[model samples]
Target: MKFQRIGEHGAERPIVVDGEIAYDLAPLTGDIDGDFLASGGIEATALALARKRLSPITIEGLRVGAPIARPQAVWCVGLNYAAHAKESGAPLPDAPVLFFKTPNTVIGPFDDVLIPRGSAKTDWEVELAVVIGRRARYLDSVDEAMDHIAGYTISNDVSERAFQLEQSGGQWSKGKCCETFNPLGPALVPRDELDPGNLRLRSFVNGESRQDSSTADLIFDVAYVVWHLSQYAVLEPGDVVNTGTPEGVALSGRFPYLRAGDVVELEIEGIGSIRQTCRNAG
Candidate 1:
């Protein structure tokens, strides 16, 4: 099943997506958050639909927010794609390179992306984001890791090169945490609805294709990433994991950095698409 939250930025209402029709789910659940997913949110939504308990509502002009309510954390894996690593001139890591983007970076799929103050090399990364459905701590195996995922979403891991590489002492989080850096979803699609491992994801800037690749190229697939991270930290429900991106980012020095008014669109097959316009920070 697919789920979405539509309305103004902090005032979104949860709804279930059935093709182009959207059914309001507020009558059954408050919001699709960690507690809801961990305590049978999917099952509850299914039952509500089967019993014909929801009313289809119109979302003609409302904004679509990230599907899950603010996640506890937004974790990211870097250099997981061999070509992407090569493009960035970095060696392939032996394990998933983990990083964190504070939850504040999360923004609606179509929201405007702000180029942070003094930024010169803001870039885009199209990645498959994994939404955890259950707490995962020291997961026993890849199968166990897979079981903990609730669904998938598309994420544009917007970044700044100078802050990430030059001025911040090599800490990627410095560039990753700017407000609106992580534009996350149109919907959270249940794992059963699609296979996250084989989807094709791409990024475009101002209508020009920049990155084009598939999840099949991931060095550490979704299951292994969850299993690997769980050994060191507890991954709670509603946590977001950006699996990694493939090649063709602006950081390769092939394309220019984003500027105010640049439009960036990120799409991942099955999950959905996100289109964000870059603007200067006020």
Candidate 2:
């Protein structure tokens, strides 16, 4: 089942999408959060649907929020895609290069992306975000790592190259944490509904294609990423792991960086799509 949060910002209610119909799950759960997922919210939601306990709600013109309320941490993998790594002038990493985007970067998929003050290198990255369902620590193998994942969602790993490279002394997080940097989700598609390893994910800026790539290009893959991460830090339910972005980003110097009034659209096969408009930050 595909799950989503829809309503005004900060007041979204949970719902499950079955085809074109959206059934409100607010009667069963207030919001889809870390606590909800840890307590088997997926299973409970399925049961609720099967029992015909939810009412179909009209979602016309309503906003979509991040599928889960707020993640514990928005962990990211740098250079996980071969072409993306090459485009960014890095060699294929033998192990995942990890980074963090503060939880505050989480915003609805349709929200406006802010071009931070004095910014000039704002860019976009289309990524498949893995949402962890179960606690993971020291996983023995990649298969074990897959068991901890709840589902997948689309995340535009928006960045600013100058802040990330030129001014940061080489740290990437400085450019990654601006407001609305991570536009996530039209839905959180369960693992059973789609193949995490093979999916077509892409990005379009102002109706012109910028990045068109697939998860199949990922050098680390999803399972290994989670397993490798578990070897050090603990991953909890509702924690989002941005597996990495495929090539076609603005940072390649092939395309101009984003500016105010530009619209960015991100899509991942099976998961869903997100449309964000760029705006200048005051």
Candidate 3:
């Protein structure tokens, strides 16, 4: 099932999309979003509710917002794809590599991506994002990790390779935490509703395809990454984990970079696509 949030008269409401978003589920789910999603674990309850009543909302009338409201963190993995690792001249890591960007970096699906001041290596990374569903720590195995996932969304891991590689001595956070780095949502499909093994992940800049691949290429798959991160920090429901992007990022490819007017998009099979227009940060 796809869970979403929409705006009505400048106010936002949670919605369950059966066919369209505006058919209204107030009769079925009671409240807009915070409840339904935070209610009984969105995956199970949403599917169960849709079985009895279809939503009255039409997908067109409502303005879509990020599927998960106010995520706690927007975490990411770098160079997790073998080819991407090779292109960037990075060695294959022995374990799941991790880094983080502030949740403040999160923006809506179709929002604009800003090129930070003095940024010359602004690039794009099309990634598969996992949204956590419960507060978890010390997960024992990969299976236990998968159980913590609430849903999936497409993310544009917009990066500034200069800030990431040049100025930072410690971590990649400098290049990654620009104002509009994380573009999330369109739809958040519950984990059980889709298969993660094979999804055609693709990215395009200014109408030309750039990054294109599938989840099958990750050096460390989703389950292990989650389980590993759990040992360090507790995973909370609604926190986003960018499972990492496949190859074709500017940092890895022929050094293509975004300009003031470039349009960027990332899509994954089944989940959905997200787009952002590029503009100079004033």
Writing each residue's lDDT as its tens digit, candidate 2 over 116-139 gives 999999999989999999999999
Model 1 backbone overlap count: 0
C-alpha lDDT of all candidate models, in order: 0.92, 0.91, 0.79
What ranking emerges by lDDT with the best candidate at the front? 1, 2, 3
For candidate 3, the per-residue lDDT at 213 reads 89
Candidate 2 regions exceeding 4 Å error are none
Per-residue lDDT value at 196 in model 3: 79
Best by lDDT: 1
Model 1 ranges off by over 4 Å? none
Error of 3 at 182 (Å): 0.3
Candidate 3 residue spans exceeding 4 A from truth: 8-11, 20-38, 41-55, 59-62, 253-255
Residue 83 in model 3: lDDT: 91
